[model samples]
Target chain A: MSLQPLACIIPPDLLAAVAREADATQRQALLDTLQLDQSFRVVRAENAARTVETTRALTPRVGAGTPSRSIYDQKHSTATTPGTLARSEGQAPVADVSVNQAYDNFGYTYKLYWDIFHRDSIDDQGLPIEGLVHFGANYDNAFWDGAGHMFFGDGDGQMLTDTTKGIDVVGHELTHGVTQHEANLTYSGQSGALNESVSDVFGSLVKQYHLGQDVATADWLIGADIVGPQLAPALRSMKAPGTANHYDNQPATMDGYVHTTSDNGGVHTNSGIPNHAFYVIATTIGGNAWEAAGQIWYDTLVDPRLRPNATFSKFAALTLRSARTRYGASSNEAAAVKTGWDEVKVRVR
Target chain B: MNLPGSTGDPSGLPDPAHPRDMSDAGLHVTYRRSGGIAGLDLVAECAGSDLPQDHARVARDLLDAPADEPGRGGTEREAAVVPAGADRFTYTVHITDGTRHRTLTWSEGAVPSAAEPLLASLGGLATPQRAP
Candidate 1:
């Protein structure tokens, strides 16, 4: 809920994907802007530090639903923020789904921490859930800066909706902080991709639990709500990784056509392989996603063995090892874990 | 966000053997289908569109294409409900922030009748000079 305290280290690809196919010069300009944005992020962090010094507010809370209390919504663009005068403690917004969606997403994510994980908000220090719904000029995607905050982009409306439409997205973005706090996975190549996959795994589990949807009903896709109706429906699909989204001029394969450009070495696209792996593991386990499958992935995410830029194969091995370690070597969960990885074309020793 | 069917490229071909009307490569229509439905990959050559992209336009339209939709067949889910070739269809908006290229597809239809108002609230895509 406070200002940015950490780095806004998004691999250039996310920004690249945001600016796919831009001309060479324009692309470079955008990249420069991104770098500038990062520097600006530093400035924002300094500001947050100043605010903390002035207010000394450690616990983030909501006053009125309309006027979002989280620092994330300051200077927000949508009517969703409602822009209330200030936090009015316990006041609900009557204007839009934006406020309610923020309220619910924050509540669900907070509960996941407090109950399931026994942690607090994104920071694990009861950090306020700074949520900015409808971010950017109809942008798509949600992000959690190292600084204790979250922002959601309203989809262009064809494939995606508001990035905040899904609880898992919020959880996924917030968990990015968790990953940074724990593994600090470098934002590119295999490790960065693994970092992204971990967030997807945890994010999906959060959605599954909140919706009470069993693995059977849950659709395994990231940013399911962000895509426009005309384009691909899935930003990423798990059951069929490459099957997510393919349209006119968009290549669906991962090896070559998938994004492997500069920014963080395509963490988002490479993550598909692992996301598919997790889907298989949960399906093979034949129960709730948060059960053994969730436990195994969660353990690996926090395991000291996980290293930055660890390739998909390495992480797969780690999951296999973690599952065996967490739930006895002979456990069905472990077998399912192995099978899941195998199905994803990941073979372990 | 009504997952309209009219949004995606309408000429997605399942059978390449069938020669498509290949006058324009850019306007070749494609469609996002439903999960249970089988897709048709038609060899569609686009025709009709002839516009060149500028630096600013490319940057804005780069990510203009829609992100992947959920529940399968991309934009086809929304297309299924609309009358064939209905005005309610999928459209692609290529935007360039003068830096990165983004393609966004515009699809409108049956997101969930309840979502009509919300979709409108999200607003339409920015108009830009299309790439020739």
Candidate 2:
């Protein structure tokens, strides 16, 4: 079936806060973003219903191929849909920092999935990657439309900088597309939180894999490079949830799980629980995160048992099963997986 | 966003849970807009004696709008599966006039065309901008 088209890096609550709290000048932009987001949601949903379904079979593209990337420029206007083409794969570097960053970071994201997971492009079919930069006037978010496109905004200088600056942010958005092609997790409650957490996990993995950083060395911060000077030091910290400067609502364990009815059931906030689990596993495994820890998560993401409406406990159980299957049940990898979930208070049984 | 998972029955009967009758017992209306980019809540109230006359008058005018009709004109079929970070807003207009309590919910990025006037009147009252 066709996947839903609803993904944005910056949570709705954050944008809502800016809209409600920002000065008149800033409030208008955030308001416009909200409108823009609704418009896109409608478009994606319609497109998905009509678009052809692609099965997740890990099959390579027809002509044994390479990465295909295209970058566009919106010129600070939301009127045009994908904007003007700025850069493409195998092309020379462009003058715009956002364009180059999107191109380069997207390349790394593609590399992480290809080299590490041995998966093809987004669709495992050499699907072309596209990005639109400077999407709106001081737009403070980035997103991947389920239709295979990444849109980055020049953040409002006060709360956020250029979204393209964050590699993990791009990775996070792309991984949403990955989840779409795979489990197609429902976008609400725990399933929605799992969808969000999956993106964060792979997003960090993309950064780690690109930088050659091991789990111990990785910062474990999702949007460290994108947050503006005035806001939090980072969006959310996997290693330490509430440590991020201004955005301190995230709870590292189940005890702190938020039960609000916003942010699609607090998908962004509750994601910290699973994020910490992944961090614990990777650090305890003590090596490149992509090796064992990341692999286990990846396997779980692509596993058939991962249903559309998976809960944290269900997902944790799947990871344990994947770990045991990949490594022996008594292997340290399996025990580390259990320990990771246990620390997060997600009973795997 | 108001009545999440409320199944559409196709029949014309109103949902029993959503009692449409406004209680003449006393008007108490509360408007809560949740789901901005930050997912912060904006709450505004117009109750028996607590609200100032000026705000109460505004609330009276807002309640004059049809309570039964959805604020946004059309239902977005795509919203059923919208993922987190979609950056849209969800608004809950809670009306409690004495024994009669009714809540109407709508979600979107832009203010509903019909509810703009109501939201505009309440925006300043509920979501006061930080004093810069």
Best by lDDT: 2
TM for every model, in the order presented, reads 0.55, 0.70
Q: Which runs in model 2 stand beyond 4 Å of their true positions?
A: A1-59, A62-65, B1-132
Interface RMSD of each: 16.6, 9.4
Alpha-carbon runs more than 4 Å astray in model 1: A1-90, A248-259, B1-132
Among the numbered candidates, top DockQ falls to: 2
Candidates' C-alpha lDDT? 0.52, 0.71
Q: Give one digit per residue, the lDDT tens place, for model 2 in B87-131.
A: 334555655655554555555433455454444344435641111
Lowest-scoring 10 consecutive residues by lDDT in candidate 2 chain A? A49-58
